[model samples]
Target: MNFDEFTGTVQHRLELPGTGEAVRATRATLTTLGERIQAGEATDLAGPLPMEVDFYLTGAVAEHGQRFDWNEFLDRVAEREGQTAPDDRADVAHHARTVVAVAAEAIPAGQLDQVRDQLPADEGWGNLFELVEADGAQAE
Candidate 1:
């Protein structure tokens, strides 16, 4: 439901190769989001939630030494790296942005239904996000 329970469930249930570190990184990112919200440094619409989630995922990917096509978009938008000027890259950025926006909103809703709807069907981070959503909903 909350961060602690969500993290705990991930630590227990998920069996990804590097889920442990991912779980830890996720918690840290969520904490940062909470802090930013408290400080009024960000809002849900400005895309802080998705940006933070990607930032957290980027770190986890680097830490695990895993490669993903989405990494570049994560870097370009989340890390504010070089502009993605080409038409294809622009499309990638747009898709990632939408994914982030949905996931971010689901995180706050803390409902399994909402999280599952937002998560990608690919079954890694998406599954973990769903787990958090489920736990959050159960708590309520």
Candidate 2:
């Protein structure tokens, strides 16, 4: 998908106010994800994405493969999303899932799996893939 289409899909999925919110959601989720996973894996995941959106994975990562658990991942994403309230974590997680689901659709098959492999399933990191997993089940 192109940049507009990708952001539009995310906007629709998250029911955000506009493209700007969608962009922010995408940025927040992917950038945080980029930080959590290895740099090479992040680059691989970003490969099929729109260049505009892919930069969230590429441009913002200061250290790839940084070890962080799911809660820390959500915290960073929430901060990037400007959701300061402690109660906003649920919403932040939902937003991240939505963005990831949209991204799973955009990238080639198996690419997301590589990204998934980088995160530990035992640490609740699998929660981020809930939507993607559901979608896969439905497709099957």
Candidate 3:
């Protein structure tokens, strides 16, 4: 998908007020994800995405494979998203999941799976993929 379509879909999925919010959501989620996974993997995942959007995955961070857990992941995303309230974590997670689901559709086949492999499922990080998993199941 192109930049406009990608952000539009994210806005529609999250019911956000506008494309700006969608862009922020996408950036917050992908940037955090880029930090958590390896640099090479992040580059590969960014490959099929729109250049505007892919930068969130590759260019935003100074380094990758930082080895943070799910809570830290959410914290970084919340910080980037300007969600300061402690109570906003659930909403943050939901927004991240929505962004990632949209990204899963945009990236090439198996790219998300590679990203998934880097995150530990037992650590509750796998929850990020809930929407993607549901979509895949429905497709099957």
Query: What would the per-residue lDDT of candidate 3 be over residues 1-140, giving only the tens digit for each residue?
Result: 79999899999989999999999989999999999999999999898789999899999988899988899999999999999698999989999999888888867667788889988988999889999888862211
Cα-based RMSD of candidate 2: 2.0
lDDT per residue as tens, model 2, 1-140:
79999899989988888989999999999999998888889998888889998999988888888999999999999999999798989999999998898888877777888788878889998899999988872111
Global lDDT of each candidate = 0.36, 0.88, 0.88
- Candidate closer to the true structure by lDDT (higher is better), 1 or 2: 2
lDDT at residue 74 of model 2 (Cα atoms):
92
Give the clashing residue pairs of candidate 1, or none.
Answer: 1-135, 1-136, 112-133
- Candidate 2: global Cα-lDDT? 0.88
Q: Any residue pairs clashing in model 2, and if so which?
A: none
RMSD after Cα superposition, model 3: 1.9
Task: State the number of backbone clashes in model 1.
Answer: 3
Q: State every prediction's TM-score relative to the real structure.
A: 0.26, 0.94, 0.94
Candidate 2 weakest ten by summed lDDT: 131-140
